[model samples]
Target: MKKIIAYNMLMVALFTPICCAQDIARIVEDVGKSVVVVIGFNVDSTANKLGSGCFINNKGVILTNAHVIDSCLSLQIELTDTIIEVAANSNGLFCTTRKTIKIYLTKCS
Candidate 1:
């Protein structure tokens, strides 16, 4: 009886971590849609660049400094999740020879 009690107590200790992990998994799974992954490409590295755009309604916009996305023909916006999807591709905008791309989010739209 004494050994059985000790063994049961050990099992309870192991069970505690599993319960906590389940709680964390549930929270992340429920709120994953609110997160995003931002990716960009720029050919010119010497100058500072960025862009700013609206992301409300049916639009998924990318705004950055003037030098950030210069010469980038496209920008990719994806959801941060297991089945990550590239939700949008921005049409390129240029100032001088530098181009910045603006993509519309498909999934979010």
Candidate 2:
């Protein structure tokens, strides 16, 4: 019985990482679908900042760092082949009712 238990424990230890690796791979694939490129434009309409963010939900809500869109007059969100341009408000909020897009900013540093 002692030898059987030891063998089972060793088998579990070796297989556990394999199972976890599959889970990690699935998570990475899922997250890749939600990733987007955030481009910030200066007052002169030139792209000055670049960052990456992810869609938090299916309603076009994006979650990104505050610094990515800071001091910008407009922003361009690129997802796959779609590029969306929206104006930013003074309080760092980007909203466009026409496209039902909203951006939520958080300080990453």
Candidate 3:
């Protein structure tokens, strides 16, 4: 009886990580709709940088790395779900004017 209990515990411990990974993956899938690909453009309408960001609210607010938009004259944010459905690269999205957008840093103090 002791050996059987130990064997069962070992199996449970070994499978715990796999189960946790699945749960994490499911969470990501659900949250992926709120994720976007942030693209920066120069004054000449050329690509400057690319990075990922997450929308914090339904008002189109995005949080991303500072370097992602460095030296950029314009920005474009494409929803991951839309990108997946379009099957196109970052160029598929339209650029948004700077006046109509806002970005915030999420760094820990």
Model 1 — TM-score against the truth?
0.36
lDDT string for model 2 (17-47, tens) is 9999999999998888799999999989999
TM-score ranking of the models: 2, 3, 1
Better of 1 and 2 by lDDT: 2
Task: Give the winner by lDDT.
Answer: 2
Count backbone clashes in candidate 3. Answer: 0
Tens digit of per-residue lDDT, candidate 1, span 1-109? 9999999999999999999999999998765644444444444422232333333432334334444344554444444432222212344542121133234422221
Distance (Å) between predicted and true CA of 87, model 3? 23
15 in model 3: Cα distance from truth in Å?
A: 3.1
The lDDT of each candidate is 0.45, 0.81, 0.65
Instruction: Sort the predicted structures by lDDT, highest score first.
Output: 2, 3, 1
Tens-digit lDDT track of model 3 for 16-91: 9999999999999989877888777776888778999887886555677877766665666676534321112254
lDDT of 2: 0.81
Residue 35 displacement (Å), model 2: 2.8
Error of 1 at 38 (Å): 1.4
lDDT of 2 at 16: 100
| lDDT score for candidate 1 against the true structure | 0.45
